[model samples]
Structure formats: C-alpha cells, structure tokens
Target: MAVRAVRGAVQVDRDDPDVIFDETCSLVLEVIRRNDLALDDIISIFFTMTPDLASGFPAAAARAVGLTDVPMLCATEIGVPNSMERVVRLLAHIQTDRPPAMVEHVYLRGAVKLRPDLVRERRPGTRGPGGSTATG
Candidate 1:
C-alpha cells in the first residue's frame, strides 16, 4: 500500500503532433512498464515540456496509452541557460507494494543525457547510486 513516485523524460523530435505524441507515449509506457505499475496504481502525472514544444499536450500521450481516468497535468518548463531543447518530462505518482528502493526511473533519447546513470537498461537486481534497487 505504498505510494511511489517515478520520474521520466524524453526528447521530442519536433513541434509536430506526430513526433511529440509518439515519443511521449513511448516514454510514458516505459515508465509504467519499468515499474510494473497497474493503470489504477497511478495516482497522478505531472508533465512539463520545453517552451519550444507546443504541438500537443503530453497528457494526451497518457490517454493514448490507455490512462483514461488518471489525473494528469502539463506545464511549460522554465527556460534555463544552455538547456536542452525539445524535452518533455513526467512525474508519475503510483501505488505499489514495492518499496521506493525498487523503483526505476526513466530518461530516454536526448533526455538520457540528463541522467546517464539511470538511462541505461540494465538487468534486474542492480543498485543505483541512491542505493535504490533497480530493474530496467
């Protein structure tokens, strides 16, 4: 009955709906799959995209991936100095019996560079720098 939070990010190919939707969908799916989360286990999701990306709502990507009833929100990322462009980020609150240490966060595509340590898909039973247990 523990609530765990999973974070993930992916880079959009462009401002086109097709690129944004497809990449966002793939990222959300991975975040769910990597954590072995049930649809109902999800509590809410927070999404943010760089100012340059505005072709679609990333929440729609959640719906496209079958998250019909989950509460989701989207916002614009703050423009920072020398920041990466076309990036979309997501924070998912999920319920699970697993401890927080067992959760695996995701960062894909260009976003992978943001957290290279967590981006690589390694085998299960690995221990990350945070001392958290990881799987994919």
Candidate 2:
C-alpha cells in the first residue's frame, strides 16, 4: 500500500468554538466522503489554522467524529499580511492501494478560493494537489 496525503481546507465564518468544531467536522467528513476512505485507512492527520482561529483546536474537533485513536496534531499558520483568515486546513495521511495520482484533495466553502485551479480542474482525469492525476 502507498501512503498518500489528502489535503483539505474549510473556512469558518467566525472564531466561536462551536462554529469551529462544526465547520471542521464538516470539512473532515467531506474529505472522507469524497475520497471513499474508511476509518482504518487513515494513519494520521495534521491540522493547521490561521492564527485568528483560537477558540478551539481542529484536532479535538476531529476526535469528536471518531478519530480518537488516530494520531493528530494542531498548529498555527504563519500570520502573513492580509492572508486568508479563519481557515482550518488538514493534511491526512492514509494507507491506500490507489496510486499517488488517484488521491483526492478537498477544498470547501470560502477556502475553495485558495486553490481555484484545483476547484476548476476537478473533473475526472485532472490533476489533484502536487500535480497528481486525479481519476475521480
């Protein structure tokens, strides 16, 4: 099996903990759904968010959705001037039989603007993140 990294991000409307948790859950669920991944396929997940989203940790929100035993961490993104705000991003590593080119990358809500090229080029046989050819 190959280890593939699935990239995903979602922008929350505000800094409230509840909103953070809810949006994060949505992001994670969407990633899993789009990739057709099972729980055991996940190896670890790394979450990062803009410095402004301090109300909660995305890792904790992931745990609330049955990722409790998986290794996970949360970090703050570098505060670049005028960069996007309230965005929670995740890099989930998973064991898959699929080739590198078949992995899917997800971007939802406002975060979709971050990678307009991927959103626009997401049709079958297009390239996903890292220039991997996406079959989905």
Candidate 3:
C-alpha cells in the first residue's frame, strides 16, 4: 500500500451558495472518478477558494454530496497579482498503490487556462468535469 495525492482546480462563476455547491460537487465527483478513488480511501480533502468567493464554506458541498465521513477543510487562496478569480481548488489525499507521479492533477474551466501543461498532460482515462464520464 502507498499514499497518493491528486489535486484538481476549477473556478466558481458566482458567489451564491447554490452555484458554489453545485460546481464544487460536480468537480469533486469528477476528480474522484478520474482517479478511480473510493470514498473510504480518501484520507481528507482540502478546499481553497479565492477571496472573492465568500458566500459559504465549500466543504458544505461535500457534505451535501454525502461525503460526511471524509474529513474536509476550507481555506482561502493567496491573492497573487492578476491571478484567476473565484477559483476553488481541491487537494485530496488518498491511500492507494499508485505513486504521486501517476496521480493526475486536474485544472478545469477557467483554471484550465492557468495550467495548460497539466490539462494537456492529463490521461485520457481521467474524467473531465461532469457526472461520471471518464474522459479528461
């Protein structure tokens, strides 16, 4: 057994809780499915939002999606000059046999433009943003 980590990032269009919740839920599900992860295998999930998105905790979206058993935390992303705005990033620590190099770090939506290398390098098996389609 080994420890693996995968990170995925996307931007929120609005600060409203409903929009934030829907987007975050969809994003989390995509990452998990892309990495072929089990909910129980997740050690924890950390979410960070840009300062502009301050309607509520993004972690709440995880709970709403029934990930209550998984430890979740929320924070604010550093405000760098000319950085993408209203972005929500997620870092998930998982227990698996795969190495970190094999893990896919996802960057989607507006964030995808921030890291084209990552987006382009992502495996075709990895799912993009959506319900359960594995097509990143």
Q: Could you give the C-alpha RMSD of every candidate to the true structure, in order shown?
A: 5.1, 5.3, 2.9
lDDT of 2: 0.84
Question: lDDT per residue, candidate 2, 1-136, as tens digits?
Answer: 8899999898889999999999888888877766788888899999999999999989888899888889999999999999999999999999888786777678877888798755645567754433356686
Off by over 4 Å in 3: 120-136
Runs with alpha carbons beyond 4 Å of true place in candidate 1: 124-136
TM-score of each: 0.86, 0.85, 0.85
Please report the TM-score between candidate 2 and the true structure.
Answer: 0.85
Each prediction's Cα lDDT score?
A: 0.84, 0.84, 0.79
As for lDDT, the candidate ahead, 2 or 3, is 2
Name the better of 1 and 3 by TM-score: 1
User: Model 1: per-residue lDDT, tens digit, 20-50?
Assistant: 8988888888777778888899999999999
**Residues 1-136 of candidate 3: C-alpha lDDT, one tens digit per residue:** 6777788888877898888888888778777766777788788999999988989787898888778899989999998988889888998888887777767677767777767766644346645532234554
lDDT of 1 at 89: 94
lDDT of 3: 0.79
Best by TM-score: 1
**What is the Cα-based lDDT of residue 34 in candidate 1?**
73
- Candidate 2 regions exceeding 4 Å error are 120-136
